[model samples]
Each structure stands twice: as C-alpha cells, then as structure tokens.
Target: MKSGWMRGIIILLVFVLGLSIGYFLPDRKEKMDVPVASVGDEIITELMWLNQLKEDYGEQVLQDMIDRKVVFSEANRLGITVSDKEIEQEIQKMRKAYENDEQFLNSLKEQSGTTLEQLKEDMRYYLTWEKLATKDVVVSDPEIEEYYNNNLYLFQEPEKVHAWQIVVSTEEEAKQVIRELEEGTDFSTLAKERSMDLLTANQGGDLGFISLNDSYFDPSFLEVAFSLKEGEISSPIPVEKGFVILKVTEKVKERIIPLDEVKDTIRKEIALSQVPSLPQVLDQLRKQAKAQILINDNGK
Candidate 1:
C-alpha cells in the first residue's frame, strides 16, 4: 500500500515537473528555424538561442524548478496551504515599506521583473514553504511579551502632523492668501488656485503626514508646522523658494505602540527565529523525498 502511494506521488511530481519545464521552454508557435535576432544579417535562430540558454542556464534553472516542486510536494504531504488572503496580507505588509501602492508595484517590477499576478503566485509558493518549514515552531506568550519589552523603540511613533501648505512667490502673495483664508475662503480652494508649488497645488497643497525627522521639509517649515495646534494656520513663513502658509490638520503625539497592538507581529518574528534556514529545510525535504537529477548541462 505504501509503495502504491509512493508511485502516485511520483506520477504527480513528474506531471508538475513537465509543467515547470514548459514554463521556461520556447513558444511552440515560433518555429525553431525562425530568427530570434539579427546582427548585420548574421541571424541568431530560435533553436540556437534555446541551445545557448540550455547550455548556460539549464542546470541552475532545472535545480530551481526541482526545488519548487519539492517544496510543493512536501507542503502537500504536510497538508499545509497558503490562502490567497494570506498572500495579500503578506503583500500588504511589504507594501508598508514603500511610499504608495504604485511606487511599490513599480519597484517590484523594476527590481524583481514580476507583475502583481506573478508576485501573488510567488507569494503563494513562499508562504507555503514558510508554513512547512516552521510548522513545529511555536512562540510562547511570554516570549512575545519579552520581545515587545526589549524592542520598545521599534514600536514608538514620533510626533507627526498632517499638514497642508500654500506657497507663493512673495510674502505679500502669502499674506493675501492668509487674508482670504481668514475671511472663510477655503484653504484647499486657495491652495489649488494660488499656490505656486505646482506638485501639491492640484491636490490642495496636501503634504500628507510628516515628522520632524522627515528631512524633506525645511527646518523652518517644520518648526512652524509643529508649533500650530490642530486646525491652526501659520502666518507667512520664508522658505527656499518663497513664502508659505501652513495649516496643521492633525497632530499625533509620540508614543510607544501598546503590546497588544504589536503582539501578533512579535509572535511571528519569534516563531520565525526558531525555524531552520530555508536552504537547510529544503535540503532535508529533498533528501527525505529521494529526489534525483536525471539530466545535466549536456542534456544526457
């Protein structure tokens, strides 16, 4: 019965292996005789291009394909699965490191050469492997509490303000804007119409949430911004280009995030620390599965 079960698994693995190879294989619609590129009438045929790729990258590419298959098989054996929602949550976690979603997507494409859909699939595979690797690892509540206590600095939020601005070329123009604002002319409307800072003007001079440590805003500008209470507007302040009016929309005081807020994150970190290195886990899984390499660079 065990031998029969092994045979079934091997068959499934072979099918998956073929699919992996097909992903890297050249398109069937393009004939091997077709020219892939030309340098002054010296044509590089599709067949030649494929042959070169096979010789140069075949071994490593094949190894990677096998590794992916092994990870999938092991994950299946262990009944571990990565849900789409989990993948999305992981992506959201990564996105926090970037300025915005578009910026994150652009960076991902430039740095990893992958689309969002491709990244989702990659995340699925990765999350699956991570689960398999850390299945037995556990983080106690005390460990989480200790980690939180030791890493208090990591959880602190600096004082920040959500602010807007209306920049003008001269102090007189800035003062005029302040007068209009005082008379109940909407600040955002004035910003859109009169602000000289073209970048934020259309968006009603929104600077978003900013901290003193941001370094993007001038020290003078930051000082004026931080001095204002929420809903208070600053008088004309001199900056590099011209005079500017500032409004503080919201203020967040510096505070350490509570242990309850970061406990799940700390738990994951502690559990991850207990898992073996990824390569070590993969090697052990491969050995247990009795994986073999049937082809080399020579394709024999």
Candidate 2:
C-alpha cells in the first residue's frame, strides 16, 4: 500500500463517534441544537451535518476502519509486530526524497496534510498489514540475486553535486556577490540576504544534489555547476534569470549500489509480488475473522 493512503482516514473515523465538536456536550438539547451554519433564514444544526457526513462518506470510511481493525487483530493473534525502529527506518527511506529532516517534515505537512506522529501511526498500520499479508510468502536467495542481476540499471547512482547558489538580477550584482564570497563572507548567509530565487533564497540557496541529467535545471546552469570542483565557486553565469553563481559543496561520482545494501528491499519486493494485493489480503482477513457490519444504508 502507498504510505500516505491513510492521510484522511483518521479524521473520517471521527464520524463514527460524532460529526461536530458539540456532540460531546452534557445536555442532549444543546448537542442536537448546535448550529453548523446559517442558511439566511434557517440554521443548519450539527445533526444535519452529521447526517450528511454519514450519507456521503460513512460506509466507505467504516469499511476502511474495519480493514484496519482486522489487520491489527490478526497481527496481535499471530504476534506479528512492527517496531518503532523499523518504522523509523521506513521513514528514513522516505526522507531520502527531501533535502533535510525539516524539509521532509514541511513537505509531508504540505503534501499529505499530516504530522510526524500521524505518519508514524500510518506506517505502523501499513507495516503491520504487510507483515500479516506476507507472512506465508517466501523469497529465496537465488531469486534475489537473479532479480538484482536483471535490474542492475535500477541500482545505479548518477553523478551528482550538492550545490548552493546566489542568484541576482544583474551580472554586476552576481560579480559583487562572488567577490564577497572570495573575501570572507559566508556563502549561505549571502544567499539568504541577496539571492532573488524565492524558492531557495530563504533556505540559503540549498540546491541539494543535482545530476547532469536533471532536466529541470537550465543547461547553462548545469554546465557551470557540474564543471566546478568541490568548494570551488563559479563566476557569474548568465541564465534566463539574469546571473547565478554556484558553489559545489559536495560531489558524488556515478556508481552502482551494492546488492547487500538492497537485498532485503528486493526480498520484500519479491515476497509482496507473490502475495495478494493489500485489498485482497484485507478481504481475506475479514472473512477469517467472521467480521460483521452492524450498520446498513437504511440506518436500521
């Protein structure tokens, strides 16, 4: 299952208990009378909103929750557990996509609308589900080695440089920036203070690892960026956005990742491929558990 498929599931579970915050009130009349909106002459109460939510998302959300519960129950019965360390490792793997921990967290919030703890809980559920689903599946050593040999290109890392830049609207401005860097001024500080690239300026122009094949970067920028040695700063290079001076902080030569580093990942991939899809696994689990739905569409 995709890591973020549970993004909005938790909030949807709230509908199972009550729709609005006022549902927790001590007085029955107040709970029923809580207004959700004003329709000019009419007031829409919490009950109305609750009914609407139930009508729209209630059945699918309940089924999702049921699937989660079934997995957890089966895992508990079988003593299959996902540890905090395992979850952290998975999170670290996911974190590789971002520049830093802060960037990852920020992107997680922006893209998934979830906090770290919520993400952890989601991971726990997903990992537990995987363990339960794939417990019977086996991947042999030969299979892993064969898969690795067949997909060697997938393991190759391209030549990349961890670089920072200071973009200015004028060539003279860029030249002065370089002069400051040549003297004693800090590159990151100068970037924050003067760089015009709004996306990276606030982050001290951190262009975390760019490869020559990265199509998003301008050809002129890549030409200058890739040519510079580590710790060496480029002269003002003209681009669509006036001038950009790059400093390569770190460099990595192209190489294939070792099989040992990716063996467990390969094993998991092979095992998962052999097992039923996640939804199918959940459906089977529900059957084994003899799960029953107590609610119906008619609210009977």
Candidate 3:
C-alpha cells in the first residue's frame, strides 16, 4: 500500500511539472518570433516589447512598448551599449529575488511570454539607458538647496494632542459629572460607568494622540481642545447629539528638522527632477549616428 501511494505521488508531481512547462514553453517560443519594433539593424520583437511594457506600465501595455522602442533607438544612437554579462547578472538577481517560490517564477515567465534568458536581455537594454541618463544629467547642490528652501512648509510636522474624553447624552448628566469631578470623582471610573463611547470608555475615555486635522471629531471640539494647555480640561462642548468634555493630557509642538540631516535625500530628489533632459541629449547623439528602421506593415 505504501509503495502504491509513493508511485501515485511521483506520477502527480510529473504531471504538474509537465503542465507548467507546456504552458510556459509556448509563450517563450512565440516571444522569439514576435516583432516589437526595430532600431537600426536590431529587431525588437513583440514579445520583447510587451515584456518591457509589463515592467513599466501594465495597464497601457502597447503605449509602453512604443515608448521603449523610441528610447532604445535613442540609446543606440548615443552608443549606450549593455554587455551580455551585465544582462546575465541581472537575470541571476531576479532569480534570487524569487528563489523561495517556484510557482511565482513560472508565472512570471508565462505572463511575460519570455524565458528568463530573454527577460535579462531586455533588462540590459533598459539599464544601459538609465546609466547614460544618470551620467549625463547635471543637477548642482545649489539647485537642491533652492528646492529645499522653497518647500520648507511641506516638511513641517503638525501639532498633535493626546487626551481623554467623556460623551454624555444629556446636559444635566454632563453638568452632574462636572460637579462630581470638582468633588474629586475619578475620571476613568466615571467614564467606565457612564460614558457612551464603547471603544475607549473602559480605558478611561483615552482617545490617544490625535492630529488637529483629524476628521473623526467635530471642528468645535478640536478648536477648544487645541487651545487648552496641557492638563487643562474644557467645559462641555455641544455636539450634534450631546456634549463632549475633554482633558488635554498631552501636547506636542510642530517640529521642522534641519535640512542638513536630510541632505542626501534632497540631492536624489534634485537629480530625479533633471531626468527629462536625457532624451534631448540622446536625440543629439542620434543626429550624429547612423540608424535604420524596417517596418513589416508599412501601409498600416
């Protein structure tokens, strides 16, 4: 019986492997013949172009394909060449990233309609253009500093408050609670006994630290709560249904950290902002280089 069970398991494994390979192999084979676009003597097939599209824009796959071909033509004109060894290394990195999941790797291969080898070649072309852009674009430290100064408000931390609240349905009940609190009633005990906010009533109505812009509480409540000094309690603030009395347990000042602490982040942002000029540089290179394009469906 054990021997029969082992045989069955082996057969099942073989069947699954066969199905997976069969499903992925057709897409890979089609990728070899698929015509994407042409750059000079290089013919990028439909499979190669679609794979590039999937990496960048999954929704508008065809547009990405056209854009990639345009970029590739520009890269070739600029003499931005990627070596086979570089492509191999990228493929190895991808394989490592998906090492734990064989199924995921297989699905990626099928979805791309290209084998792992072809994907690496596509990646090589993409990286070569990226490297060229990085090396050629000029963004100075002064520019970064200027951007930082202009956007200082974007980095300011808003004031935050931590407080406890008690919501009572009736004005008389609210007044009675205030009177009891004046007579030394425990706020937490009173909240647990009478407050209607089920989530925090047991924890003495502790609402935790909330930002001034928090949408949960009413604007009137926030206005009064923010104005109160720490440890000060507010008078019953009228709401839609009842009244809310709050104690300002804690208050944190808005903080703006120094730019020096984030200089590297600022520099990267500055560099990225200069990327649009790369294609123009590539265009100049194309004017100086020899290129050819052959379209199979010229009339279309």
lDDT values of the candidates?
A: 0.76, 0.83, 0.63
Best by lDDT: 2
Q: Write the per-residue lDDT of candidate 3 for residues 19-109, one digit (tens) a residue.
A: 3444478765554555657889998874564444334433233333344566677667777777887676555545533312343356454
Each model's RMSD to truth, in Å? Answer: 8.3, 3.0, 17.4
Of the pair 2 and 3, which is ahead by lDDT? Answer: 2
Ranking by lDDT: 2, 1, 3
Best by TM-score: 2
Over 1-300, each residue of candidate 2 has an lDDT whose tens digit, in order, gives 253355556546557457544445567546666787997889998778777777876776777678779999999999999999989989988886665566778887787777788788888989999888889888899999999999999999899999898889999999899889989999999999999986678789888888888787888788888999999999998888889989998999999999998998899889999999987988899999998789778756
**Ordering by TM-score:** 2, 1, 3
Poorly placed runs, candidate 3 (over 4 Å): 1-144, 183-189, 210-216, 260-268, 271-300
Q: Give the clashing pairs for model 2.
A: none
In model 3, what lDDT does residue 103 have? 38
Alpha carbon lDDT of residue 147, candidate 3? 78
Pitting candidate 1 against candidate 3, the one with the higher lDDT is 1
For each candidate, how many residue pairs have backbone atoms clashing (under 3 Å)? Answer: 0, 0, 5
Q: What is the TM-score of each predicted model, taking all chains together? A: 0.67, 0.85, 0.40
* Position 18, candidate 2: lDDT: 71
